[model samples]
Target: MPTARAIDTSDRHPIRAFLDLRWGGPTIMLDGRAIDAAALPGFVALDADGAIAGLITLLDDALQSEIVTLDAVQAQAGLGTHLLELAAERARALGLGRLLTRTTNDNLDALRFYQLRGFRLHRLAAGAIDLEREADPAIPLLGRHGIPLHDEISLIRVLGAD
Candidate 1:
């Protein structure tokens, strides 16, 4: 298997191209506002063949840190976990003290995954996707398991402690 390494986005263009392909853009929506994932720092995992296997984008606002996106090309390989851990580690390094993320209510897999990684359910932002879609129509109306992509489930992980 090919090893995964952090992507060097310092060069900018290549990373942007890759991100644009995976996500609609470097910009993402959170709590009714538009935020650019490429504008901030993130971690991308390169597979053994030097292909993009997984990535996690982040945003640090005045209140807390948010994981904009997390994707793995291959599943059940600990790729998601590794990327998440790296994002959390970076948050702690920045003295943020906590890492937060949001997933659609339809995404049961994401809910389970984040909880398994020590993130607690924070809140549910009902109809949040409506606002998000206004800015970006690409936000699918329905997601996996036939669930309607509507509400936003907030999850948080505390840092700087055992």
Candidate 2:
């Protein structure tokens, strides 16, 4: 299993490269805005070879911690879960009340992954992605399993009383 660690300033270059390769550059569209995910504080899981295996970037506000991005180089290997666990621990330490994330309607895998790990449906922003596409035309019309990517689904996991 890979070990997860906090992302520090020294990690910027590699993180930026990783995000660019996987996410089409470090800027990710969230809640109708473009966010520089590489600039966010989060966790990175490294394999035995010292290569990044997975990563999760967080955006925290006074009320909650938002998972801006989560990616695992190898699926079903528990890397994603480990990264999420670390994020939750950080959120709890910061006195955040919940962990939030958003996924496209076409991303059935993310919907299942988040829910199975205690996240619940928060809202369905219908046609959210379509509006996002207006700003960034590169946003694909179809996503995983060939589903039409139109809506944005928000999910939240409320932290237990600390």
| All candidates: CA RMSD (Å) | 2.3, 1.1
- Highest TM-score against the true fold, candidate: 2
Per-residue lDDT tens digits for candidate 1, residues 1-162, read: 234444465625655766789876766766666676666667777766656677777788665678888888777789899888887777777778788998889888889999999999999989888778777787789888998888889999987653
- Candidate 2 residue spans exceeding 4 A from truth: none
Clashing pairs in 1: 2-48, 3-48
- What lDDT does the true structure give each of the candidates? 0.78, 0.93
Q: Ten-residue segment with the worst summed lDDT in candidate 2? A: 27-36
lDDT of 2 by residue, 107-127 (tens): 999999999999999999999
lDDT of 2 at 135: 88
Clashes of 1: 2
